[model samples]
Target: MIHTNTAMKTQYHPISILFHWLVVVLLIAAFVVIELKGQFPKGSEARELTKTIHGFIGQIIFVIMVLRLFARILFGAPEPKNPSQALAMLSKVMHWLLYAILLIAPIFGILYFQYAGKEIHFFGFTWPQLVTPDPVMKKSVENIHELLGNSLYFLIGIHALAALWHHYFLKDDVLTRILPKMKGVRN
Candidate 1:
């Protein structure tokens, strides 16, 4: 007899949850790397290595984001059952902005790398160069990339705070909406 696999009823899609958490972890790691690399003196191989790792992981995030977008479009997601009108609108806007940034930031990063005369390695495969070396262009792209990073941090912070506010102060069903439901809990 063959056993069929069934999806979990209580949890979000395993892959979705995994990707969600992975993105968070990767973002934290990226921030830490960026901070450490900046604070330490430059011109060292360690700094260079850290930068390469950051770029590499960033590329991974780009790919993951693409897959996530596709998954979201194809599979769709359940929205919060009940939320204040303002909170609901904020959620929609924030999600769209998040997607916009996820899609654009990586392209800019890749462009920055190319303009800086660097080849991108994606999991042992090298992506062809997209731009000829130009320090000025590279500098411009780097500045934009940095700006996007800062904006993304603020957006993510707001998202996190909103969730916390719902759980703690608002005392609404907002947090429970997206979270995997507990088996024994009665609504």
Candidate 2:
């Protein structure tokens, strides 16, 4: 049986770890495609193709994130140890913020897609439209959606930096608590 104790164990399930890392990689790829590839000439096939690819990957992340959230509540997360009250609250609030953004960003993106009179397809499977086209609404939604995504990058950066801080400065088990278990460690 996988033990849930924080003092002894240093990680979550292997499956959860797998999903976490996969999402990280996918998020990086999606971000790069959207923000870093804008130097290419307009009307280029490559630019359009990258946008489609980014959209498809974003859709995939949306599905996985919902699954991850469900798993968190169903299985329950490990408890923290002797954390300062403020730090504990910070953790909880930051986590919920991340979850809220993850859920909202994709929905907004899909709404923008429909509003702009485009069909959203996930790996060639057509996703149903959530809203009809309206040029003004489309522009507004798309702009805010893009802004939220940019905001996510900074939030994610803070999360990463916090993890590193716990790992190196505090020398706490916070980082290890989510790391993959070593072969000899009891699960």
Among these predicted structures, which one has the highest lDDT? 2
Q: Rate the local accuracy (lDDT) of all candidates.
A: 0.75, 0.78
- Tens digits of per-residue lDDT for model 2 on 1-187? 3244434444565666666777888889998888745966776888777777887888888888888776665455665532598887787787788888877888888888889888888866897877879999988988888888998899899888888888788878777877777788843
How far does residue 47 in candidate 2 sit from its true spot (Å)?
Answer: 2.1
Listed in order, each prediction's TM-score against the native is 0.83, 0.86
Q: Which residues of candidate 2, in runs, are more than 4 Å off?
A: 1-10, 184-187
Model 2, C-alpha of 175: deviation from truth (Å) = 0.7
lDDT, candidate 2, equals 0.78
Number of clashes found in candidate 2: 0
True-structure Cα RMSD, model 1? 5.2
Residue pairs with colliding backbones in model 2 are: none
Give the worst 10-residue stretch by lDDT in candidate 1: 1-10
